[model samples]
Target: MTTPELGLPMAVPAQGLPAAVRIYEVGARDGLQNEKGTVPTEVKAEFIHRLADAGLTTIEATSFVHPKWVPQLADAEQLFPRVSELPVALPVLVPNERGLDRALALGARQVAVFASATESFAKANLNRTLDESLAMFEPVVNRAKTEGRHVRGYISMSFGDPWEGAVPIPQVVRVCRALLDMGCDELSLGDTIGVATAGHVRALLSALNEAGVPTHTLGVHFHDTYGQALANTLAALQHGITTVDASAGGLGGCPYAKSATGNLATEDLVWMLRGLGIDTGVDLDRLITTSVWMAEQLGRPSPSRTVRALSHKE
Candidate 1:
């Protein structure tokens, strides 16, 4: 396997050494994006602030995509600036050059570009083919680099797609390499339809690593569709990945996945990590409070087993 030339330290420690992992909280964006009711701008900002207080260093704050697509985050202009000044590392999603323009105008220090492993899902989600979606991000990544902003590339449906069945491992590696070649600082592998298994994740990671994608440059975003997210995440951990994306209270869903659900709950992931004696620097109790608050605001019960168990004890 060709080693991924990680210009910086891999999020994981040197190979063969266990390292503490960092969790990227996406509740403020991915979570809220799927909510039936709208979350106010003030409320969004408050939620982000509370997440930061809970010791999450990286937060996926919002997206600058068309308001028509995600009405929940229509206030990108208002929300980006509000989050930029926070001490935490806040990265917003930019769908294209237009979204990048808005995020840059707001002095965004970091931004994300999304692509998909499946052509059908890519077309429906971004209205373009895999090549077109990646091509669209070229200018965004270049401009972001020129301005010294970090760029992250997201490959949705990394494991499986609702429309395309099981994704070919080689194709997944190709799209991931394209994103890396396009100058994205990192690549997030998304199980958008929540169909990933531990073996699937392990196989993909090994393939990507062999194909010259750095394991450290990889992050995992899994959904609990088959109740395999946390287990898959541990498989990634075994391969030396440290950045995992999760939403508080497990708040998200793929619009395309039939009977799909949200990302793994941050609190639940934390619970697992804590049991392993790995330090995440997160205050689980405070996270529970925040998750409960958001669930109340959304009028839905949290999907986190840890949250539910904790609530029962309380």
Candidate 2:
């Protein structure tokens, strides 16, 4: 095939694209956690089941946070146990030891912890400074490993922040190293506000590589706030990153950062991967259908370009 025009997206080089990619589906957890309306326990369970049926291998289940903090995911206790039987990794987000304890009691086999790259975001998001937040997660990560569960570390605001703009690569790497050293099996760098460009993505990955962080143990989490998630993802893929985090129907935003918006849609990522010839194990058509059904449940159409395109013909 030839390019319609040698442009930015089509201009993407194939030299570094991975043979396959692993998508970390965050619809059930990250996507809906910030929603204003309460999603029924049954609906959340059904959503995870449908995502698995659509061939998502790793679906973030829910968070074990205090209901007073996040009412939308307050049903984590009831939600996780029901979807625990799904034949995939149902990792829940654990904020501290208490959250971890709750997750362990619910038979969680895998878990994730989040940290921030900037001090301002850390204080706003975790109410702790950078070191304090990492210190808090150390025990959680260590204990989760002791419980024989896998742990994923997330570094939010890796690329940029609403309060502090243009985050330095070294600042992001320090937290990244701490997370990995704390026994996190994998670390995902999140572009929380979606201010990253392709150049920024490549530069950050390069810095991580130079800092001795294995690319194989890293993932990329990009938001579509500026419509740059896929482009950043392509840059990451070319840099040898295989794990990509996405949400079904592009259904997520940072509750803390009002400027931040929904996540990169699963269908859009699948569509790009299909064109790149990288296998994601996701059925795009089925994923689109799932997202469309979910949008109906939310009383709105999906924000995913591919989902909207496929679900409704012009």
Candidate 3:
């Protein structure tokens, strides 16, 4: 695969690895939102800039939820305009039609709406039942599509919910189907609490496949709370799931689930992908550098093992 040490769309072989995998960088929005203190709008835009400069083609920028809901990302309006000129897709999380309205006004080209397979998480995060949350997102997804924008759906707690020990495969599939039926271009199934193992990963994908959802239309968002994010990611890759959601420097967790830790670190995922001869088009050293700089802003060391090992080697 030929990739500039810094640019994207690297050529990759179709042999054991995926021809190419899209690393959906969710650090700026997801990572920052979970932080204790709010980041300055300038810092957030610069963070997104550095990430895109490192060759992340798609970065989840900011959420359009109310400031009361996510105070860390309260400057969505200010942050979006600053990073609008970047050459990457910036997909923001829109909780409902009102949030979508906010995103539209800012010229958002892509948006994502989230649902939960477990009623416990649904109630906790969306303050609605599982069915009600999906119904709520129906119009939001439809409206985004009508506006010629790319719409993605998310099903949180697909593997396990904090209150619900294990999520049923049927329940997960039902939500996935509903999102796809609602005109979502793709559905990202999240292991929100990160209790997923390789076996569980296979089981969920198998169930989704049997339910007639093609693998191409699916993405996997795995958290590393239990230290199984990479293993679950390998399992998902083996199942032909090419899109993986990760946070830069392992920087995010679900605010509603205090037990949840950071998402799989982008540095870690790229390290594994490169070793497998899979193309991710990310500059590993640059990603580590960016994470290190971001860690400075957060006043802590990064949680990524790859970053830790590589930093010492340097």
Model 2 sits at a Cα RMSD from the real structure of: 3.3
> Model 1 scores what on Cα lDDT?
0.86
Model 3, span 254-280: residue lDDT tens: 899988999999998997787677878
For model 2, residues 1-314, the per-residue Cα lDDT tens digits are 33523211242326668989999999998899888999899989999999999999999999998898899999998888789988998999999999999999989999999899999999998999999999999999999999999999999999999998999999998999889888999999999999999999999898998888999999999999898999899889988999999999999998898888999998989888877767789877778888888888888888898887777722
* TM of each candidate vs. truth: 0.93, 0.95, 0.94
Clashes of 3: 0
lDDT comparing candidate 3 with the true structure: 0.90
lDDT of 1 at 85: 79
For every model in order, what is the number of clashing pairs? 0, 0, 0
Q: For residue 161, what is the lDDT in candidate 3?
A: 87
Report the C-alpha lDDT of model 1 over 1-314, residue by residue, as the tens digit: 22323221113232452457799899998888877687888888888988888899999999999999888789989887777778989999998889888988887888998889989888988888888888888998998998899999989989888777999999999999999998999999999988899999999999999999989899999999889998998888888888999999999886555556888999989877765555688988888888888788777779898888787522
lDDT accuracy of residue 54 in candidate 2: 96
| Weakest ten-residue segment in model 1 by summed lDDT | 1-10
Which is better, 1 or 2, measured by lDDT? 2
Give the better candidate number (1 or 3) by TM-score.
Answer: 3
